[model samples]
Target: MRIYVLSRQKLLLGLLFLFTVGGILAITQFTLTTPSLVRTPGTYYMANTPEKVVALTFDDGPDPIDTPDILDILKEKEVRATFFVLGKAAQSNPDLLKRLVKEGHEIGNHGFNHDYQQRHLVKEMNQTDQAVYAATGYHTYFYRPPGGFVSKTQLETTNRNGHVVALWSVDSKDWRNPGVKQIVDNVVKNVFPGSIILMHDGGYQRSQTVKSLGPIIDALRARGYRLATLSELKTLDSETK
Candidate 1:
């Protein structure tokens, strides 16, 4: 009887040890995959506001072909948006960047080449900032990492550059060119007050994005939601709060 009791206690202790180690390993894996959640400060997924307003932000943009179509649609609708542009793209199409500022839109840094490794983030950010400023004379205050991948060093570097890291609450997935209707549905269905909607005008085939833009704007406006740039949305966020 004594031997059986000792063996049962040993089994319970071993199981407890395994459970603890497994829990720790699981947490470490989670943090590694979702570093933005653990490392960044003021990383806005969505603004906490009750007002019927949303920020429309585009990434990997200033494309000569698709960007003009997007700007035309926004102009017709009188809706302004923020464009997170790559430095290399901006240098190639300085006029489009200037036109974005002239049309009352905002420009955010998307790094020099949208580097996936997230190396030299600060240098990339500065290069993008200088490019936009040279083209449009507008200084950017927002930086969105490519693919929304954030690291501890990237976060620190971005903050040190005096830029807020912008993330999306509603992703249109338009980059996939997943049918015009699907893209419109993604934004309209997911958008809420103070929500940031992500779309693309540059990387990949964006004809679907351009086609869906007009409808998305109309849908959001029909729902009594005002489309604003990131800077405008930030003001609304503060006011509503």
Candidate 2:
């Protein structure tokens, strides 16, 4: 009995030791030992400003049907946004690209082919710039990677090309087709001062985005938020700093 009691106490102590060690390792590995990644220079996730303004950015577009409807809504609301154009899409729909430029909206390079690896980021960026320039005689100064994914090479190339990397703070997730009301709520609820809203005008069937656009604008306006382009947001960011 004495031996059995000693054995049981030893087992309990052993288990306690194992649990404590495991907990320490888990915390250290995931928390203190892990480093927070530094955002590369010349890249912006969202503009920093206290003003009641936001930038609406659309990605993967120049879609013929939906892009026009989005533009029409923007025009009706007298609000401007930034369209991050895919090189292939821009090449295929130069007229839409032209319309984007002519309508006082801003354009940004979204990369060619929507390549995920972005191994040749600089080339992709230049090709996108060329496609837009060919259509509208305009040069884009902002770069947002396909799928909003960022890589060190992409950021370096954007910096090398003297363009700013624009990423979004508030994602509409309209690409998910999560219903128009859900999309609007996703954006409206997440938005902050100088927020850059991520939406879609192309890359896939974006009908839901089309429907959510006007309501998002009206809701934002009702919330006393002034919509602006990426460039305008950048200007506001500068003033606050």
Measured by lDDT, the strongest candidate is: 1
Off by over 4 Å in 2: 1-42, 239-241
TM-score, every prediction: 0.83, 0.82
lDDT digits (tens) for residues 1-241 of candidate 1: 3554458889999999999999999999887665334434558667778899999899998899999999999999998999999999999999999899989999999999989786888889999999999998888898899888886677777888899898888889887788999999999998899998889999877999999999999999999999999888888676445
**Residue-pair clashes per candidate:** 0, 0
What do the candidate models score in CA lDDT, each in turn?
A: 0.88, 0.86
Cα shift from native, residue 50, model 1 (Å): 0.2
Q: How close is candidate 1 to the true structure, as a TM-score?
A: 0.83
Identify the candidate with maximal TM-score.
1
Worst 10 residues of 2 by lDDT: 31-40
Error of 2 at 241 (Å): 5.3
